[model samples]
Target: MRGGNTNGPDGNLRKDVETALLRPNLTPWQRTFLTDIHARLERSGGQARLSDKQWRKIFEILGRPNNVIALPPRTVTAYPPRRQPSKLFRPRFGWVGRRLRWRLRNLAIGFLIVAAVALGQQVFNLGRGQFQSTPTSTRALQTQEFSVTDGDTVHVVGEATGTRLVGFNTPEKFSPQCEYERQLGERASSRLRELVAHGSIQLTKVACACAPNTEGTSECNFGRSCGVLQVDGKDVGSILISEGLAVSFVCGRTSCPPAPRPWCKG
Candidate 1:
């Protein structure tokens, strides 16, 4: 009788109904009480199901208040544990060290090669008599035409050629009064012609002071032999000197005379 309502819609009338059953205005405490009751009923296998929106509202109510609990201090932990003193300071022999050593070796080799080449050049120049200083003038002979007069003397076409020949005195051409001298001269001349006839000869011009003869022929005061005359890398003067056909007559300020031998005197 306490639970029945006589005016319930579509129901047969019950004799007893409470006035509190029709009340709609519940207080906050009463609402809380009803919520707890409803939750208990749901746990006891009631027909009510919590949708997504209702669950979110319930979660928000249970979460911590904004100013109540402070978050733990944030910490940055490094990955891959840091090296200790011994490990951190250990020496590493890497490719960089090897590369530096190799570079140094190459530099030393390059320096050695340069030094060797320089030394070789010095030795070569010394051996070839290039270090010997001879005073040679740049004056051209007035006469360009010259003929093989004897072994050493060359006849010129004009007075200028004879003047130019003053510094280089050769043997007389076919002299009867000095027949022995003439024969020696002819022999020397023939030998020279044979040696350089078809070969290229480089004439080096020189200047000197020597009196010309009445026939306008000049003689070499420094003697006619010495110095270098190269042919295919062979020293012509040295060859003749070695053969005793010519003497090593140092010319210019250096006063070395020709050897007083029979072959060289003529």
Candidate 2:
């Protein structure tokens, strides 16, 4: 006689057999029987019917105490419903989501690297005097407060240290290499004094090209601080250069070029 539906709209029998296939210690006969039932259910699309003997065998393998006749009105606990995988743990969007996240992380890392390099370059420039922002210190000088040492050097009234004006070089006056240099140095010094006589003298200190402990040596402008002198809002170096009293002298990243030899003028 035909028994109850094995694979039907209820699906309990088919699901129970499928659940039994997952048990680890099932005998080979039990596994083979459950697997055959699953295959038949798949082929018949849950419409497969079993005979009474087959129904008894299925319940026996599934560890259920009921036969097909006792299955209609009772709940089947032999196999519980399969738990659905949670959306949070499942890869819903597959590889696309993972790739996008990876790209965003790389972009953030790239931005940080670029910022670090730019900061390093700025520090390097500041140390070398190749790039500067505001002056480190500013001094206002009165006519009598400073004495012109030469065309480009000056000694302030109260300070023991002298200041060498940057951006221009004048002839040597302290120990001229030639008579022509001595004469030119005198003319330049006189002109510098004239320039400082009338207008506001402002000295803006800047970084000097010298090692940490070598301020008094020739490397650090011979013990003098480096400054930019502005008189009446005009750069003293620019004035001297325009009047042919001094030649333009600028330092690179490391140090200033050798002083121009105007002593033997061509």
Candidate 3:
């Protein structure tokens, strides 16, 4: 035989085994199995000596032959003899533990992939104008304007707006995708600043989205609104998009900005 039942780590199984063997009602086979198990446990320090199969032999020996559970023969090793990796194949708690860990690892990987797909789908729907709950419109709002933070982002002097120019998005100054993205972002910011610097810039809130600024650590509007920036009655978005400095987009209604993306890449 490749191996017999290993001794139990705990001494309890052997105690039960010893008590059963001493019973006067035991059949000859039962007495014999118990005696052998007791002896092996003693030799091994404190545990049952029977291999899992040998331990199971007690069930058959004690049970009426006809009433015995239909378990595999105890004579067979948990792992068949002569197999190359008989050790891992053994039906022991150790092997079961390893199998469980492997299963959990695969399950975690599956969850990550599922989450990624779901996030991607949401972005796709946003770009396709599927958000119906929030409506978009373009209206020239006359308000006290403060400064142009970037090409598309603007901040009102006294917290009056969370507005960004609709219809188009510029490269991100905070988080750029690549060198090209960074360069484009700087150029866009400069252009918008120049446009506002000269005379006056008015926002035509057209096709606006209710996108929240998520970058606020506590209380700050870091996000921009989607709208047409009206300069002398001309659309700033149209000009920038035409010049390739910005891209045509609807903030929450259309697609999100793309390029060197990690947060936006979803």
Candidate 4:
């Protein structure tokens, strides 16, 4: 029969009343008790409020009637069961797709390495020729004696009968300027014979139209035989051009064009 006191020490009773009212499920007798407590607290002029500790205890007592309110032993949800990560998501693979990708990468690297090595070898071979020493004089051709026929022609005795000196065409013996051309040719031939008579001469056999065969035939025999007369290291054609006695002759070959000089024209 204790009436509620607004200014009195009823902190525990107010807590109990709040806890009982917050319960999700209550019996008929519990509901009536909480309503009566609430009414009594209202009449106390708003000074009675519940403490937290006493409210928790009263909440446990009032919630005992509901089995659902007992919180079902904190059961883990099985609706969205934790899926084990798929094997496809793993990076390690022994299949063809991964192996093919690895092989392609290795092939690309190997090709790049081979290309670099080939380029380096080519450059090394190109520069190797520059460091080689010049050839000795003993390796050069032995000189042969010759008689000067004219300004641009010479007669050299050979083991075989008729090997003509190439690269100059003198005027005909009875032509209008024959005397002048003959004098020039004789002088040129004498100078060439003197330069090559005792010294070694490097002869390079080239295909030429004016070269003669063994029977003195101007046409090609079974072979493409020709003559290039070189004295000391100078080409006889270039020497004749420098002396103004003979002009340059260019045969119409795949490599050489027609001679471009006024003197060479018909």
In order, the Cα lDDT scores of the candidates are 0.40, 0.72, 0.55, 0.48
- What value does the lDDT take at residue 58 in candidate 3? 51
RMSD in Å for model 1: 56.8
lDDT of 2: 0.72
Clashing residue pairs in all predictions, respectively, total: 5, 0, 13, 6
lDDT by residue for model 2 (74-153), tens: 35568778999998888666689889988999999999999999999999887666325444545457878877877988
lDDT score for residue 159 of model 4: 21
lDDT for predicted candidate 1 compared with the true structure: 0.40
Clashes of 3: 13
Question: How many pairs of residues in model 2 come into backbone collision?
Answer: 0
Lowest-lDDT window of 10 residues in candidate 1? 12-21
TM-score of each: 0.30, 0.46, 0.36, 0.33
Give the alpha carbon lDDT tens digit for every residue of 97-186 in model 4. 799889999999999999999999998876664345323222245444434444344334332222334555443221213345435545
- Residue pairs with colliding backbones in model 4 are 150-185, 150-186, 151-184, 151-185, 151-186, 152-185
Candidate 3 residue lDDT tens string, 108-226: 99999999999999998886663463345333333345456667766554442345665667776444545566577778888877766664555544443333443321122223333
Q: Where does model 4 exceed 4 Å of error?
A: 1-156, 159-161, 165-176, 210-225, 254-266
TM-score of 4: 0.33
- Candidate 3's C-alpha runs over 4 A off are 1-144, 206-208, 211-226, 251-266
Give the better candidate number (3 or 4) by lDDT: 3
For candidate 1, lDDT tens digit of each residue in 1-266?
A: 01111122322212111222233664343334336535543454442322212222322333312111112245797799876779777677699978988999999999999999999999988756643543352122232343343444333343122212222233432322344545655566676566555554433444333344312221343123222233444545555556544554444443324523343233
**Best-matching candidate per TM-score:** 2
